[model samples]
Every structure is written in structure tokens, then in C-alpha cells.
Target chain A: MEYLSMLPGPTNVPNRVMRAMLAPIINHRSDDFVELYTDVVDKTQQVFQTKNDIVALSASGTGAVEASVINIVKKGDKIIIPVNGEFSGRLAELIEAQGAHVVKLQTPPGQNATFDQVKEAFDNNKDVKAFYVVHNETSTGTMVNYLDRISDLTSRNDSMYIVDSVSILGGVNLPVDKWNIDVCMTGAQKAIAAPPGISPISVSPKAKKYMIANPPPTMYFNLARYFKYYEESKHTPFTPALPLLYAYREALSIMLEEGLEHVFKRHKVCSDALYSSLSAIGLTPFAKQEDRSISIIALNYLDGLEDKIFRDTLADKFKVLVAGGFGNLKGKVFRVGCMGEVNKYHVMRTVSAISSTLAMMGYKTDAQAGLKTAEEKLKAL
Target chain B: MEYLSMLPGPTNVPNRVMRAMLAPIINHRSDDFVELYTDVVDKTQQVFQTKNDIVALSASGTGAVEASVINIVKKGDKIIIPVNGEFSGRLAELIEAQGAHVVKLQTPPGQNATFDQVKEAFDNNKDVKAFYVVHNETSTGTMVNYLDRISDLTSRNDSMYIVDSVSILGGVNLPVDKWNIDVCMTGAQKAIAAPPGISPISVSPKAKKYMIANPPPTMYFNLARYFKYYEESKHTPFTPALPLLYAYREALSIMLEEGLEHVFKRHKVCSDALYSSLSAIGLTPFAKQEDRSISIIALNYLDGLEDKIFRDTLADKFKVLVAGGFGNLKGKVFRVGCMGEVNKYHVMRTVSAISSTLAMMGYKTDAQAGLKTAEEKLKAL
Candidate 1:
């Protein structure tokens, strides 16, 4: 069956982006390859809004996340982590695997932890060496405003702040430099509209200083080795996916031409339309309006409806795919992604598809109401 | 200037394969995606010549290597790895990261670790858990005949045999079942003619028994988690690159249609012709004849000339890109690849390009003689 991807990642890669990704692969050591790689690094810097060394590694985003945890936190060191989403909780698990201790602050799904809670945890844990948080929680469409609060906490405690902007880097503005974020890493699959392989990690001077003091836990993820490899030869520690690197350079150029502000605005508009349409059909959003994600919308499914059935129906009947709630809110909420190449037309079509599919499934809802509401919202934009 | 890839993966992706790679990205949870992933896994099993659990990962081959080492070896387990090529040496480094001791066996470049040397080391290190080796050493173009020797060694000793066929899987015969290999892994970009992301790794029942006895290393590369994730969900440990996965299915289908024996024969023919042409130009091959790679040919530059100039000339004047010597052989040897779509015509064209380009650079070489000899070799095919 023909399918439309509205999942968080492996998001809809535009045809142009896919063509760019399919460009002929080049030899990594060649002069032409060096030029291409250097340009890609620069483009990533422009998008990241940071001048820190943006080292790209040939692995999944989880690999980079492990690198962040393994590099900064040494054995027996204390780390502060949040357990609100699956990804964040997984971060803590990785840290524990390194033989480090993680003190986690637990919160319910779709609920944002306040700065006070983080500060209290920091104040209570005197041996903490680093604090990690996810900027945008993909499991639940909740946005955490850590950039504004993390600097104060880290400055007061003299600890490193590792921010994960994997799903929100290009779709939203989280200036790494201005926020005093010690280390920020992102994946290419989500907002960059590129096939996943390379994850760009920017290490602040502070983070490098931390690495200098503490040895890296994993040899492959060592920042010192990365610096030597990239700074000396503009190559990775291992053989990189050359075609994916070329495709990223092309994807970054397209992002720059579109402008980050335009990208942010597009995401916001689509998300707002989705929220308005869902609410008009008598469904509530899982996240608070103020904390809702501009890249994704989490909908609270109506009473007596199982989410697996709903998600399957959307895929089987409407050919539109959406993510069901994971972890805590499984079968309670549905997530539709509006990030990267998701336009107003695509939003309207999705709303139409979902509304009709819901009606066919005998869910009590006004099918016309959602589409009308989405179109009206798009028209206002 | 248009660049050509001659390095071992990511190799030059053909237009047909690239177009297949450019296919639309689908939602990871969609049935279409599951079907695509299942097809890719099934096709990969066919290539690996095994009914074992063939799983695909969304990372580079090194990550797969890391996964294999970390999943199978416990904290204090002993590993015996050949230090023949750069990649096999990397296996030692990865084993060390897990706090395991590596019983290293020295095998210099342009040579393979003799079965006697490995067996002696295994005999000495009675507590050794696994013997790690690279099937095709792309660094030196030396292919080890491990299948015949390792089967006997593993039967005699209490150790598993893990093979890295990253550069040789499709181009060479690696009958995993017949070889009784415990763990074997390969990447797609080399001979599979697809972009790199997905790495196919198969673990035999013997390997699983060892893993169950040992503790899990890291969460990210946990084989138990990977098996559970795929067996239960039919997806990966994470969101995989949908387009690349689909392209791999297509590439595998093409490979199966061509037949494995025919594929290996074509690679052998091209490599022999290219090696003969290089020898005719007064360049000695880097790898020993007894253990030479059928897909990749390693040749030393003539009489102590800088290898960079000849490599640059070939890329600039002829647009025929060949890999430079890696690791210790850098600037001493040039590597000509004969894998993936490289046939008799490719060998002739590459020989003509290399001989003519070198002749123009004042190297006392006969361009016509090399091409004529290479043409005769191709006609014999």
C-alpha cells in the first residue's frame, strides 16, 4: 500500500533531498573529499549556530549520545538525568553501563520538569559532574526549555550541561553558544531531512576541558581522537559513509537557502493547524498548549478507543502513518509529525485522512469539523 | 571536478542502485516499511548463505564490529585478534575498551596470519574467548583462508570464530554454515552496491550460548536486545534508514540474480587482469599471491616515487579513481578495487588510465604494453 510518513524520524525525506543523498560517493582521502567534508562541517556550524568544533561521526544518534555520556562522565562520576521520556531514560541507562552513577528526576509523560526541580536535584547531589536533558522529547510532544535554565544551574554548580537537540535542532532555534550548552549533539534523520548515518556533535571549550581532566570511557567516542582525526585530516576515526556525508552537505545547503526562521515558522504553522483541527473534533492535546512542540503534535485519543487499533486503521485505511504513544502513555495518545517538508497542504490532507478514517472506525466524531478547522487555521496563516 | 570513489566502502554506487536508494522514505512503523525491512533481511540471509538470525543495524560497519565485540565478550573475557590489517587491529582496540585482554598475534601488512601462528596463540592463551579476524583485509588486499583453518581450530579449542567480511561478503565465498563461523558480519556499500547504514550480522547458536554465559556489555550494541527488538517487532533497535534498506533489498535481488559464483569469478578475473597490468608496468603487488584478495588488488609504486602524484594524475587526467595505501603502507602502494560492477571492461579502462597517467609523469613505464597485456588477460576471460 502507498504510505505517507508522519512519524517523528525517518520523517518524510523530500524527493530533492533523496536525490541529493543519492549523489555519487567519493573517496574519503581525496582532496575533493576533504573540500566536501570541510564545507559540510561549516554548513552544520551555520545551522547549529555555534562555532564550536562540530565533529561528525559515522554511527546512529544513539552512538553520539553514548559518546556524550562516555566522554564527559568518567567511571565512578555522578550524572544527573531526567526520566520523563524514553530517550532521556535511555541516556541514563547508557551512563549506568559506563559504571557511572545517575541521579534521575522523574516526571509524568507530557509534563515538563521545572528548573526548580533540576536545581533541587543538583543541590541535593553534591557529587554530580554533568547534567543531561533532551530539548525536545519525541516520545511525548513536550518541549523542555532547558536552554534558559541550564546555564544558571551549570554555572552555579560548575557541572557540564549536555543538551540533546536531536529532533529539534534545525526545526527550532536552540542557539548552543548563547545558552552556554557545554555539549550539544543532533541526528541527521529528524530535522536535517537527511538519511541517518552521521550525527554532528559540538563540544564546547568547557566540555573539552572536562575531557582533558577525565579520560574517555570508550576509545571510539574519544573527543581527543575525534579532534586529531577531524582537525588534522578532516576525516573521521573510522571509514565514514561517504555518500551520506555528500547528501548532508546538499541538505544543509537547502536548509540555509530556506533560512532557519522560515523553517521554524513552517513547523509552527503546521503544528498549530494540527492542534486546532484535533481540538475542533472534540479531542484534547496531551501536552500543555504553552509546552506543545512545533514539530510534532500529541493528541489524547477519545475514551474507549485503543490506540493500536486507531494507528493500524490510519495505516491500513487512510495510508497515513502516525506514531502511537510509547513508554508511559502507550494507547493513550497519538503523535503526528509536522517536521521537515511537512507543508500546509500536507497538513490539510492528513487531517482529512485522519478525520475520515476515524469516522469509518465508528469513533464518535464530526469528520468535516477537523478538515474545516485545519483549512481555516491554514488560511489565517 | 567530478570525483570517483575507489576506496573500500562507501564504494561507487551505480545509477540504478542510487536511484533505488533515492526511493521515498517511509514511516518505520508502517507495514510497507516492515515488508521492505523483512525483504532486506531475507535477501541478506541469502547472501550470507545462512539461516541464522540475520539482523540489520543503522550504523557503519565499525559500530557493527563494536556490537559484536561488546555483545559476545564479558568484562574479563580474553580475545585473540590478528594484528594483520588496520581493521583487525581495531578489533583489538574495541576488545580492550570492554576491559578485556587481547592476546594479539602479529601479522604484518601485505600478509595474512598463518594458521600455525593463530593456533599457537590459541594454545598459549587457553582462556581466550574468541578469535577475531578480517576475511578480506582491505588495508593490504590479503584474503585469509580462515574457513578451512578456523573450522579445525574452533573444534580443537574452546573459542568462537568471528569474521569481519566487510569488504569480501558478496565478492568472495564465505559459506558461514559450512565454515562453522560463530559470528560473521558485513556492510552493504562494499560489494552490495548500496549506501552504507545497514550492516548484516549473523550469530550462530554456538555464539548465542557463549553470550548467554557472559554478561551484556553495553545497552546500545546488546545482541539480546537486538534479537528481541527484531523478533518481536520485525524492526531494528532504532529507526532505520528506510530508503537505504529498500535499496539494499533491490541490490541483493540483483546480486542473487547474478549468482554468487559468477560474482566471485568476475571479481577474480578483473583483479587478476589489473594485477597483471600493474606488474607489467614494473610495479610489484603488495599482497602475497597465496592470500591475495579476489576483489581488491594492492600494488606498490615503482622504485620509491611518491604515490600521491600518480594517484592525483589518475583522478585529474583520467578520472579513474583508485585507493591509496592505508595505515603503514601509505604513500608506498596504490590499491585498485575490482568489486561491485567492476568487470573485464573496467579492468581494461582502469589499466589504460593508470599506465597512461603514470607515463605522462616521467615514470619509465610503457602505457601500451600494460594495456595490451591487460587486454589479452580480459580476452582470456
Candidate 2:
């Protein structure tokens, strides 16, 4: 059975990308594959808006996070991480796993880190050599808007500014070069509209030099090794996921065709329509409008309904797959992904499905009203 | 124009697997995804012929190699690595990168290590805690035939045994339990016939305990952490490459339906036919009879023809992709892989392409005679 993927990642891939992905495999070291690899890297750099070298690894986005930490941070080096949601929480765990000291500036669930909190943490931790922050928190649908300020703070102190834009890379306003992101990373499956298994990471010379001085106890996800291999030959150290690379190249082409600014505007429209439609059905977004994500929307259905029951009913009965809350936000919220190739119609279908499911479950929801609101919003956009 | 992939690992994926891979993405944390993940792991264990639990990582096979070394071998632990081919040489490098003491028992580029050499290395290295070997060296087309005997030697010496079956997993005969292999790893892009990006690893209880006792300085490739996640949640700690997993499940289903022994037999037939046909076209197999790969064949066109010229002509004119050698064997040998989802027709096409390219290069080659030999050999099989 087919289901509409509305999760924060692994969203519905377009047929164009699927056809490219199913193309016959090519030898990775072949000239044809070098063209594909180099094109993808160049396109990725454009999307990242940086002159920093981009290295694609056959790994998940978390693997890229591990690569950034293990490569740049020396052992026992203190890194200030702003914890806002599930993904940001995982950053702490990943840093600790790599034997680095993590100074976490905690924020409430479904909220972004305030400037005061971030500045206070920076002032308190003078030994911090790096600042890692999640640009888009996938769990609670929050996006940090103070990243440029944070980058300025890090640069003034001569520290690295690393950003995790896994969920909002192509769908939101993230200018890596403008913000001077020393290291920024994203996964292909999230906002790139490609199948997963490929992580595209950008590394400036500062991060590269730090990595050369303090190498990680890693070989596969070693950023410098990837850089060396790319510099020598436009190929990964190992045989990469060739099919996925095909899909990634095609997806990036699609995004570029639409243009990044227009893509971000479309996502904002989709997110706004979803909010209006969901509110028509008595469901409210979890995060504030300023900190809310254009890539995803987290909704609260608090009329004596369990989060699993709501999401499971929507998935099994309506064939719409949304994600349940994770970590500390479990049972409080459910997320709908609006990234990738999702259009207004996709968001409309999700909103319609949710309204129908709520009505079926005896919750107070007007399916027709929700559909009308969504259609009007889409038409206005 | 479409090309026939003849690389060592990124081989030709079957149409069935491709169609499955093009299926829409799903929520990875959903029950449907869990079913898919667990079934793939089970089938992987069966293909490995071991009851050990399978840990599938959404990374390249190199990530699995890093996991085996960093997780199982402690810092400063001595490991006995016999470097013969490019892959085995890479094993030594990976071990050394993890701060392990590598005792290299080196062999010639195109030769397999003898039993005496392997035994003498273990006998001399008293502090060796592990012995890692590549079952099928993809570069020189050498398969380690004396693995069971080597397993016995390692067991008697109280050291762990790890095998890398990256180039020849499902198409070759590898009895992990019967050979007492502590940790055996294979990539999805090899004989498994799936798209690249997933590494399936089978680990015994002994290796698990050792890893739990001494955790590696890793987060992404940490086996015990993966084990714990699998034990509790039956999911990867990070977002996996979902489409590749779908492709992997379908490919494993195809292999199981064909039966492992029949699969192995078919590979042997194809390899034999390719070897005979290439010989008819004035190419000599690189390795000895017993050590030659049943899944891949490396040939030396030893009439002073540049490797690049031959491979490039074949690829450009006939649209057939072959591999140039790596490490010390570079520019001396070319390789053709006849693993997973490959048949006699594929072999015939490859052999014909090589002969035609040689003929185009003003070399002595009997194109019709090679085709005739390949047909006769295939008919006999």
C-alpha cells in the first residue's frame, strides 16, 4: 500500500527524481560518474551559497554531524551547543560520544534559543572553541533566526560556527556564505527532494585546517579524507550510492530550475496554508510564528486524544503519514513535513486527511471548513 | 547512451530492484518501515550463513570496516593484516588510522597470501588481538580460499576473525558460522545487487561483548550503540537511506528465491565463461586458478597497451564500463565483475566489447572466436 510521506524527512520524492534514481548503475570512477559527482557538488555549493568545498558522503545526516565534531573539535575541547529540540539534543549526545565536552544552553521545548541565552553561554564558556546549533529543529518545528548573530559572535572569538540545516536547507532562508558558516551540513532526503543515504557537507579552510591538525578516529566519515579524494579525483573514498547520487543531481536540478528564493517562498506559502487549514479544524501549531518552520509544522491535538492514536489513525485510515512527537515532546505534538517537492495540494491533502480523521474519531472538526480555508489560502498564494 | 556497469562493487542493479527503489519514500519510524528493516536484516543474516544479529548501517562498506576496527579492537591493540590486494592494503590503513598496531604480512600485488605466510604472521605477533582479511580482493581478483583454516588459527590463538566480503557476498560461498567468522561485512552494491549506501554486518556475541566493554571513539559507526538501538527500537539511530533499503529488500528476496547455492553456481559459470572468452581474446587472468575470484575477473592485456586506452575505448565506443586497477596494480590490469543479477548475456556483451575495443586499437584479438567460446562455455554450463 502506498502512503503519503509527510514526516519531517524522507518526504515524498517526485517521479522525475525516481526515474533518475533507477537509472542503470555506472562505475564510480568512470568519466560519466565523475561528471555526475562534480555536477552534484557544484550544485550543492550553489544551494549552500558558499565557496567552501562540498564533500558528499555515503552516510546519513547524523553521520555528517559526527564527521564535523570528530574532525574539528580536539579531544576535551568545549563546544557550546544550543539545545531546543530533539535534533539539537542529539547533538549533545553525539559530541559526548566523540569524547568532547559539551556546554549546552537549554531552551524550552518548541522554542528557539534567545539571544540572551546564547550570549550568556558564550560569555560563561570562554574555553569553547566551537558553537554548534541546529538551524531547524525537526522535532518541534522551530528554526533559529539568530544564527547570523551567533556566527558573528563565534568569529569575533575566533571559533568555528557550525550549523545543522538538515530540514530547512533548500526550503528556508539559509545563506551559508552570508552567515560565514565554518561547517554546515544537510541530508539529501530532507529538503533536497532526493532519496536518502547521501550527506552533503560544506567545509571552509578554517574547519579543514582544524581537521588536519586534529583528525577523528574515523575513516569513512573523515571530511579531510573526502576532501583529499575529491581534490585528487572527483570520487568518494568508497564506492558511493551511485543511484542516490543520480537522484540527488536530478533533485538539485529541479530545485535550481525553480530558483532558491521562489522555493523558499513556496514553502512559506505551504506552511501558512497548513496553519490556517489546521486552525480551522481546531488544531494549533506548537511553536510561535516567528520561530516556526517553513519546512515543517508541529500541531497539537489536545482534546483528550493521544498523539499516537491521532497519527496512527491518520496513517492507517487516511493513508497520510505524519510523525509523532519525539523525545520530551512525545504525546504533545505531531509534525507534518512541507519540504521537498511538496506543493499546496499535498498540504491540502494532509489537512483534509487530518480533519476527516478527527471527525471520524469524534473530535470537533469541520472537514468542509478546513478544506475551504486551505483552498482559499492556496488560491491567494 | 546507457552503459553496462562492470565495476567491482557498483554493479548492474536488476530491473526488479530498480522498480522497488523507485517506490515512494515512507516514514522511517513507522511500523511499515520497521517490518522492511527487520526483514532485510534477517535475509542478510541468512546470506551470511550465520545466526549472528545483522546491523545495517546507512553508509558505505568503508563505514562497516571502520566499525569493525574501532569497535572490536581497542587502542594500541595489535592486529594481523595480510596486505595483498588493494582492499587488504586498505584494511591495514584503516586499522592504523584507528591507532591500532598493524602487523602487515605483505604479498605481491596480484598474488594471494599463502597459509604459511598467514600462520607465520600470527605466530610471530603474540600480542595480536584480531585478524582481519578481505575474502575477495576486488582489485587483484583474488579470493582467500584458506579462510576456514585461518579461522582455526585465529581461534587457537584467541584472536577475533573478521572478513570483508564486499565484492562477493551473495554470489560467493561464505559460511560465516561454519568458518567461525566473528564479524563479517558486505555492502549492498556488490553481489547483493542492491543500490550502494547500505552496509550489512553480522556480529557474534564475542565481538559484541568486547565492544560493549571498550566502546570506540565513535558515534555513527558504533556497533554496540547500533545494537542497543536495534534491541530496543529496531531502527537505526539516524535516518537511513530509505529507497536503498527498499531496493535491498527486493534484491535479497530475489537472491533467496534463486537459492544461495544456485546463485553461487551461476556466478561461477559466468566468471568461467568470461575468463575463457577473455583468454580467447588474448587477455590473461591475473591470479592463480584456485585464488581467482568466482565473482570478478582481473585480466592483464600485456602487449604494452595502456589500461586507460583499452577501458576508455570500450566505454566510449561500445558503452561498456570496466575498471582500471588501483594501488600498485594501477595501469597494469583491468577488471570485469560478473556478480549479482548478471547473466551469460552480460558476460558475452562485456567480452565482445573488450574484443572490439582491442581490435579497434590495432591489437591481436579474435572477436568472433571469443564470442564463440563464451557461447559454448555458457551452453555447457
Candidate 3:
């Protein structure tokens, strides 16, 4: 049986999207593929609310982040990253792995970095080449605010601003061009509602210029080569995963059909409902107030409750698949993804399932409390 | 209309494979995905004919090639590469991009690198860290012979032996263990008959050890990380392309059920039939007779015919897809891929289509002559 994949990525695939993926694979250089790429890239830019260039890469979201970093800066360059969640830590590691020096704007999980905190990193690093941030911290369900402020500071300096919006691109309002982001990328499996193995990355003129001057010699994730090929042949330098592009096209159609503002508001309604439901069941979210993500909801296990056993109960008994925290947050909280096709029904079921599971484990909780709260919030939608 | 994708890499995916690809995508870190990955990796080894570690990367074949290079050696290291085809040229460039010194055993297209030539390069550049070869050079349809001899030479020294069998791994006989190949990678779209996203790479213990020590800073194509993740958790370090893995498992099952020996023999039979039919049509293959590939057939265009227009006529009129050459060989010849589900019927149809297209284009050709030859060769199969 196919479980409902409520993880941050590789979520449930809609029937139309799956059918789209069933189309026979096409040659990457074929006219059909180029049209597909061009159309998808064009639609992707509209969803991103940007007129900048976007590249569709055939790899995981982490690979897109690597492409951004490696293409922009090389060894000995300094990059400042805000390290709050697992993905942010990954960016920092990837930056250092490229032989670049990294200065961390450290923040606790579920917390946002103020503009002054980012400035502190820049002040200490002085001559920083780039600033990396995770727009939505999937690890703790913290959607960081003050990105515009951070972008303003980075723009004043010569540092390029890169954001990993992997878990919350379409569902969140991160107007890439307006925020002055040098590069922003997200994978298909998350809010885009497509399968994994493909990620779309948008690049500002600033980042494109940086790539042209100092290109990485990578055979894959070579954005400069990709840009050149798209300019010349309107295709990727390497073979793209054709099937995923079809699915992405269908997903983007769904997004555009729903309209961007309506999609964001849908996420907001579901997120608010989930937050209220969890609170009604006496569960506190891991994220700080106003920093909680519409993409995911991370809730800490009540004192004396076993997190793993609770999650396993949800998966095994109710067949509700949720994710556990990573790194420092492991075994302390569970993460429920509300990205992509998640809606009021899924939110209500999730909250109800959690409440019932807690009560099944002998915890003091009202049986219909979470569900009632969710219904009240979702009634208007 | 979904035209046949008969290109070397993105061949027509079978119906069963397409159906398998329709499965709901699961979380990459879920128990289901781990099981799927383990099962697929084990079966992939059977098709690869090796007991070595196999990594399933979410990028194209070129990404896998880069992973092999970055994992094995870094800057200032010496390596020897054979530049007989377009792919080998790519290998040389990748080596330089990694800041390594490349010693080239150069040969023109349609030619195979001699063992003597490789030895000469290694002798001149002593203590070479690695030796790179393309088992099936997709560019000119040349499948190099005497790899065991070349592997023996590389073995005599401590040079790591890496092979790019992107176009011909399952169809051609490349015994990884017996041949002492450190790493051999192939794309899913080729002989495996899966979609284009994932590439299976078999790595020997020697290569794994080398990778552990000289790890590439790559986020996506880190084979060492993949190895560790598989060992500890039986999954990829990053999000894997789930749907492709399902289809790949089905594809592998198809090959194994048919038997590897039979699969290889089928490819041989098809290759022989195509060669005879092409000969009957007065088309000279680009590759040397003995160096011809079982997976693809590349033929030099007749002196006066435009290869591009001929290819377009085939696509527009007959709905047949064949590729042309790249780099120096561009516009020189056209390539027909006969891997995966391609068989004697497809070959007959292709040869007939080519002859018919040539005839329509005012060339003197017997359209039925090629079909007659193909049928005779395919009768025994």
C-alpha cells in the first residue's frame, strides 16, 4: 500500500501528475523537450514572481544548492550562512567543502535571524562573497522573516544572496526579484507537487554575471553551461529527466489554475488550522510565534512522551506518515509537511490523528478537540 | 503523438516501466524507499555483473562521470585518458576541471585507443593516479575492444580504472569484477531501458577506499556518502528519484528474467542485423568494423546528402528518431540506437525508413533491399 508521504519532500503524487510522468521519455535535444523546458521555465518564473533566468536541473534540491554555491564562488572566497536548521547547516558545510571560508550567523532552531545578526556575520567576515539562507527551515518548521532586511544589507555589500526555499517556494511569498535574491531554488517534490529528481533554480542577473566570470568546471550542475545551452539550443547541456518535466508541467498547471495568491492563502488557512488544532490538543509548535511555517509544522513531544513511538504509532496504526527531526532536534519532535497538495482535509485528519494517538497512549486530551478546532478554522475556506 | 525515442540514451521506455513509474512517490528517507533502494541496487549489480557497491545517482550519466572523477582524485594529481570519441573528450575536460593534469591517449572519431597508446601515455606521465576509458563511446558508435588488456596495464601501476558504459552496459559484456574495473557507470535510459534521471554506478572496494580518502565536496553526487547511507540505512544520503527506481527495478527484472546471457546475445544479434542491412543500403558505418557497438549504429552520410535534413525527413514523415554526431563528427554521420526494446523489427523499419527517405530525396537506393537483409539476419533470432 502506498503510504501518504507527509515528509517535506517526495509527497503524494496526484493522479494527473502521475499520468503525466507515464509518458514515454523523450530525447533531451528533441523539439518536444525544448518546448517542455521553455514552457516549464517560463511558468516557473511566473510562479517565482521573477523575470530572471531559471534553470531546471535533474537532481535533488541539495544539488541545486551546490550548483548555486560552486558556480558563484571558488576556493578561499568567504560566504556567510545563517545556521539555524539542518538545511542551513548543509549550506554552510557545502560552502566550506568548496574550499571557501564560512562565517556562521548562528541561531537556535525555531528562531529567526534579525538583520543585525546577519550584519554581525558580515562585519566579522568583512569582504564576504555571498550570503546563504534557508527561507523556510524545514527542520524546525521555522519560516524565517526579515529576508528583505537581510537582502538590503547584502545588496549594500558586494555579497550575493542565495536562498534555499526548497520546502516553501510556491506556498510562501518570497518574491525573488523584489527581495533582490541572487539565486533561489526549490525541488519538485515539495510545494511544486511533482516527483523528486528535478529542481528549478532562478538566477538573478547578478548571479548570472558572477557565473560567467567564474564558472565551475562541473560536468553536471554547471549552470553557466546550462545558461549557454538554453541560449543557443534551448536545452540542457546534459540529458534532463524528461518524465519529471512532464509531471512538473502538470503540477505548474495546477498551481497556475489555482492562482498564486489563492494557493498561498490555501496554505495559510491549512497552516493556521493545524496550529489551532495542535494548540487545542495542548501541543506546542517548535517554531517561534509568527516564524512558524505554512509549509511544515514541527511539534515537540510532550514531556514523558516517546517521540519515536508516537510517530511509529501514527504511521503503523493510522497510516499517517510524519517525519522526525534531524541532528539536534532528533527524537524530540515530529514534523508534518503541509506543502504542495496538502489542504484542509489533510490538515484536519492529521491533527485529529495526532490527538487520538496521544489519547491512545494514555495522555490527557479531548478526543474531538483538535478536529473541532480545525473544522472551525477551515469552515470559511 | 509520442514519437519513438530511439536516441542512444533516451530510448523508448516499455509499457511496464512506464506503469511502474506511475507509482506514488515515497519519501526518500522512508522505510519503503530504503527497501526499494536496496532491492534495486542488488538487482542492478546482477545486470552490471559485479559484486561491487553501486550508487544510484539522481542526475544524468555525465553527473555520474563527474562523481567518479571528483571522488577519486583532486587537483595536481596525474591521470591518463583516451580521447577517441566525444565522451572521452568530455572525460579529459572533466579531469582538467578538477585541477588534475591529464595525459591524453588521443585518437580520432571512429577509432579505438590502442593499449600501446595508453601505455605510452602512462609511461610518459609516470605515477598516473587514474586511467579513464569509455567502454561504449556514444559519439561515433565505437565500442572499444581490449578493455581487459587496458585494465591489466592500469593494474600493473596503482592507477584507478574507471569506465563510462553509459550507452552499452547491460547489452555489452563488461565483467566488472573479472576485469578489475574500479568504477563503471551507466545511465538508466540506455541498456537498462529505464527513464533518464537515474544512473547506476558500480564501485569496487578500491574505488570506495579512494573515495573515502579523497572525497569530493559535491552535495548530490557524493558516492562516499551514498555508500555510507546504504551501509547504515539502506538508502541514499539525499532525496532519490523514487518513481525512476520503481521503473528501474521493473526494467532490471525484465533483463534478469530473460537472463543476462540472452540479453547480451539479443543485442549482438540486433547489432549484426543492423550492420548487414546498412551495408545492403550502401551506408558505411563510422566506427571500425571490430570496434562497432552493439548498442548503437553510427553511419557516415553519403557524400552529397545533408544529414540533418535526412534526419528531419525521418522524424517528420516516418516518425523515426536517430541522432547525429557531435563536435568534429557533427553533420558527418547519423546514429541509430538499438539498445533496450529495439530489435530486428525496429532495425528493419529504420533501415527501410532511411532508404525510403534517401530515395525520396533523389538518391539512388533500393528501399526493400535493406529490409530483405535485416529479415534474413533476424530469422534465426
For each candidate in turn, give its C-alpha RMSD to the true structure in angstroms: 2.3, 2.1, 1.6
Residue-level lDDT of model 3, residues B27-65, one tens digit each, is 677777878988898998988889999998888899888
DockQ each candidate and list the results: 0.54, 0.72, 0.80
- After superposition, the stretches of candidate 2 with alpha carbons farther than 4 Å from their true spots are A366-380, B366-376
| CAPRI grade, predicted model 1 | medium
Provide the lowest-lDDT 10-residue window in model 1 chain A.
Answer: A212-221
The candidate maximizing DockQ is: 3
The lDDT per prediction is 0.79, 0.85, 0.85
Give per-model TM-scores: 0.95, 0.95, 0.97
Model 3 residue runs over 4 Å out of place are: A123-126, B123-126
